[model samples]
Target: MVVPLTVALGAGPAQAASCSATTGPYQKQVEQFLGRPVDGRQSSADCLAIQAFQRKHGITPTLGYAGPLTWQTMYTMYTQQWAGTTPNKAGKCPTNRGRIACVDLTRQLSWIQDGARLKYGPVPVRTGRNGAETRTGSKKIYWRNINHWSTLYNVSMPYAQFFDGGQAFHSVTKSMWNPPGSAGCVNMRPADAKAYWNLLRNGDDVHVYGRKPGT
Candidate 1:
């Protein structure tokens, strides 16, 4: 996800017309995050930059307002990028566990590891929200459904791999960056979920930890 350098340039009349003029509460933070002029103002350049980021990350509206959700998504991306190859630098996710899938709710990232070697990703994910939070501690992938339909929510959870109760590692049609989150499931992008399905199996160790920001 390389952010375009052209975002700093004027949005032109067409883009400027659609972009939001209202300075959002997170305006200054968003400006600073996007490397725009940090005057805490919503200029055409700022709006365009922010909007480009929103579009890239699947944040809705994309009207270029520097809202809280936009800021939160940006912060999550920053932390994940900073994590680099050492997502478990804090040693929260146990390395002793063989072939484990680790989900760090705090950074909204997930990955697969076999012993000490990294297998898959530290990819971005959407976990359970405030009330319907994804449970912490150790679990195991017990069931897998390639095309599972959630009777509870009346939606499709593709490449679903049940790890803890109703919560599973699955793919959702919506953006992972969408606000709130899943109903206790680990929501992933299509490609990531598919990879997880191929890489993981029933009875594999699944470790979930950390607290999602809003939760």
Candidate 2:
């Protein structure tokens, strides 16, 4: 479909020989956008939400996974809702209202408000190549592409302190699993970008910890 074509063609194919292009992101998108867990099981509310979401967004009501229209629509909803809510955090946020801190791990994602309490926003993401691995350190967002109308945000890599010239919280092509995949950047589902953007500005801190232990 054109939706798959857009993500795959724009982000490029996965480098992992064992990784399939349409698996992870596909699963992850459905779960998060549908407001369900990644187990493929749906709650009554989730099913209802998906139906309403699809109808409102003009999705075709396919068998599984979401199309580009559904995806875009969900992004709109998340961003709109997040805009009206204040980020729940502990200590002072680095910038952008000192609200939320977004952390992307290989498995789950969580946002901290007031720097203490946590709200789970476990969306999927694409990661980097094996050796090129996403990093675990703090860094500021040097730039942003709110429109994301072009491939500029898709193809570029995110730089990190620990991971060095690699890693970023960026977008990916293929469908993502719980953690998704990327070349090093945090793979943010397109739908989640706007909400994410709401939490920080150009100089806000973005910490990525793709691994465990002394990362």
Candidate 3:
């Protein structure tokens, strides 16, 4: 039972009018992320732009505050967008291993490649939190359960592809941008998880590297 989640964007004119003016801790980073002037101060334009981004990505308050979570989301978006075609340019994920899934925990992004050719994503993912970090290094997709129910956590882990013990690639109903991160599994958007299910199979190589921020 894969219950899909939908995120609505764009606030009403009334809501839009509530954009905050007070500068946030991450104001400068937010401005730079949004391509605004990196003045380290918040402006009306910066507020509106930040608010728009927040709304688009389902960030809370939607009040144009360039807070830490907002900045983190922006950073993730920036890295994912910047990855483009060459997500494996660093060659951290071995290209010699044909048809492998690459998880870059540092950037919270994942993708599938076939010996240097990009097959799937550079999509956003929520990995394990500080204590239960997603293990790095080489792994293999040992099993897949399309409609997996987690007995330990009592959650529906749709499109689960288990790579490491108790840690897998799965989709959650909640926003991937939320704080604190997942228990251990690499949590993906429902769509991306489904795509992974379709593209990957049991025994396919999985490679995870980099330390997720704060972990």
Candidate 4:
């Protein structure tokens, strides 16, 4: 899909490289993006750091490798989502008395808007897969859990904002891009999740539509 390239929290590629890139613009880019100094080589540590950033930002595969998409994404970290202009491919979000979050399954983008005013988003999100599809339509956020643990999945669901029964909007440090579905929740990057936790509150409305791909 040709999405607007927006992200929720912040904010690669398949396979492994023979070695870390040592001498390149990308080396410095990754280093700066990660807030650390790199040796200008694609070291295993570099791979891990890169993948960690990628995963947190919902980059695909978290491949322990960096490719074009990864590089471009990192390069435009602040510029991409801050323009305050809605994406051409963005879907319509509802206006509410309080905050409303719009999840467009078809476009794979989400944004929070009060009518036409963009408060946040049109950011990338991953919803539940086929049988475990996240519900479509509108619902109110019934609860908020900062450090929620899933007994069923046995995973830590941080910054969880539950809108449906057990499903919620939460941050994932594991995999944001590649997905088998979200076990019926909306998965966001960690930074976006934190931002969302700041923007939304209990009883806020959430609208979800379309279908999650790769089911």
Candidate 1 matches the true fold with a TM-score of 0.83
Number of clashing pairs, model 4? 12
lDDT of 1 by residue, 1-215 (tens): 21223233355744333677778899988988888888997877788888878877777777788888899898888999998988887888888979999999999999999987888988999999899999999999999999999999999999999988899999987877777788899999999999999999899999999999999
Where in model 1 is the C-alpha error above 4 Å?
A: 1-22, 52-63
Query: Listing every candidate in turn, what is its Cα RMSD in Å to the true structure after a full C-alpha superposition?
Result: 5.5, 12.4, 7.2, 10.2
Candidate 4 lDDT over 1-215, as tens digits, reads 11122112221233333333333347766766777665565555666677677766677755445566567555444433543466423445566455688887755667787766788876777778779888999899989989999999999999999998998999986555444557888989899999999999888888887665544
In candidate 3, stretches whose alpha carbon ends up further than 4 angstroms from where it belongs are 1-21, 32-64
lDDT of 3 at 24: 87
Query: What tens-digit string does per-residue lDDT give for candidate 3 at 6-88?
Result: 22334654433565667889988888878999998767777778878776667787778888879878787788888888898
Q: Across residues 1-215, which tens digit of lDDT does each residue of candidate 2 receive?
A: 21221122124466211211233234456677665776644334334445455544335543234445455445534643553334323322343434444554433353535444443354545455455466666666666654333254444322221213434444434444322134455555655644566655566556555452112
lDDT of each: 0.87, 0.45, 0.85, 0.70
Q: What alpha-carbon RMSD in Å does predicted model 4 have with respect to the real structure?
A: 10.2
| TM-scores, each model vs. reference | 0.83, 0.42, 0.79, 0.60
